[model samples]
Target: MTHFAPVEPDTATGESADLLTQVKKSLGAVPNMTKGMANSPTLLKSFLALSGAVGSGTLPAAVRERLAISTAQLNGCEYCLSAHTMIGANVAKIDGEELDGARRGESSDAHIAAVLQLSNTIAENAGDVDEADIETALEAGVTEEEIGEVVANLALNVMTNYFNVLARTENEFPVVSL
Candidate 1:
């Protein structure tokens, strides 16, 4: 059961309605997570803005999706895990094996695997990653800009993961278990 019911787009008025409309227009469909977030227009807008900024960052789309998958799995957020699994496969064009690898912060590509490891370490340590973690990422060819974007993307995923879990946002995508 949803602790915070999603704000219905049709009945929503003012900022919530307008934001939901924008989400629907941009994404072609308003995800249930966004609908739940629509209850707080400020929160929704913040998420959108940060999401856009990170989307334009240096990290590749596939890498971002992988990071989201890994983080969602670590956080035990089924809603995010399921949603990103779909996006990772369909939109990011990631193969099944790679998507599964992401759940464990592993990748055949050493660079991507390194980034996933860094993200997991950061999430596990609450962003208090020591020098050795940074060194490992750098040694594995993770650039400074990429590191920054990893943190940003991790923050974004963490936010949505926590929100969906708290709101008990009903999963709309094909369910992917952790």
Candidate 2:
């Protein structure tokens, strides 16, 4: 059961209401995670800002979505896993096998594999990854810009994962096996 009930968009107020409206307009639906976040305007705003920035970053949408899937899997956030599975399939066009590979932080593409490895390292080490870790991703053709974006995306997904765990947010998106 959800510990924190999602704030209904119609009942929200102030910045929460405005943010919900924006989410609805942009995504065509208010995800339960966003609605749960609406209970805290600060979290809602921060999530929206960071998510928007990362979504506009240099990383391809597929890569970003894959990173998100890997992050969610590492954190064991069912809400995020379910939501991103749908988003990855529908919005990013990631195939089933690729999505499963992403959850394991694996990819057939060598460069992307390096990115997944780096992302898993960052999450596992709480961003305390060592020089060798950086070297591996760099040697695999991960540019400084891409690394920056990867870190930012990792941070963003980590925040969402933690929130979902804390809120026990109801999974609105179609569920996917983790």
Candidate 3:
């Protein structure tokens, strides 16, 4: 069902399988998008590394999930939207209603709402977001450094979303209410 072949974990060989095993050990499963990324083992490894790096950064886990949720929404990536939705709820502990608002480009928290606005704008416009967008986030306490990190995070999700699209990656997680 994917535009590209998915490297099944049980059937994978060599380093691809190795990464799949690592994924399973870490997440209990190798997600479809990740499997699709295994089409290029290097890409799979780099993606995992970068994803982990950004996730382990100064950004709060909740905030990181929110930003990812917003970018997935902007890109209309059903795969990531579904996967991150559950993670956002179960792990990040963000409210269901609040998460739904992010899909609609809105949020109740001023700081998070500002971030959603900026991230969505960047994803939608390919980083051509105007000064006003940057100004709004800055006014909401997002620093210049944080803004850089936010942009990097958004870039990362873009890769996942497109890979999912190409892979037609099957949903491995339950879709929580947005």
Cα lDDT tens digits, model 3, 43-132, are 898888888888777778888787877877777688788888889899999899977887876788888788778888887788898999
Q: List, residue by residue over 58-160, the lDDT tens digit for candidate 2.
A: 8999999899999999998988888888889998999999999999999999999999999999889878999999999999999989999999999899999
Model 2 TM: 0.96
- Number of the top TM-score candidate: 1
What's the count of clashing pairs in each model shown? 0, 0, 1
Question: Which stretches in model 3 have alpha-carbon errors above 4 Å?
Answer: 176-178
Question: What TM-score does candidate 3 reach?
Answer: 0.91
Native-vs-model 3 lDDT?
0.81
TM-score of 1: 0.98
Query: What would you estimate as the lDDT of candidate 1?
Result: 0.95
1-178: candidate 1 lDDT, tens digit per residue: 9888889899999999999999999899999999999989888998999899999998999999999999999999999999999999999999999999999999999999999999999999988999999999999999999999998998899999999999999999999988
Residue pairs in collision within model 1: none
**Alpha-carbon error at 125 in model 2, in Å?**
1.0
The best candidate by lDDT is 1
RMSD of 2: 1.0
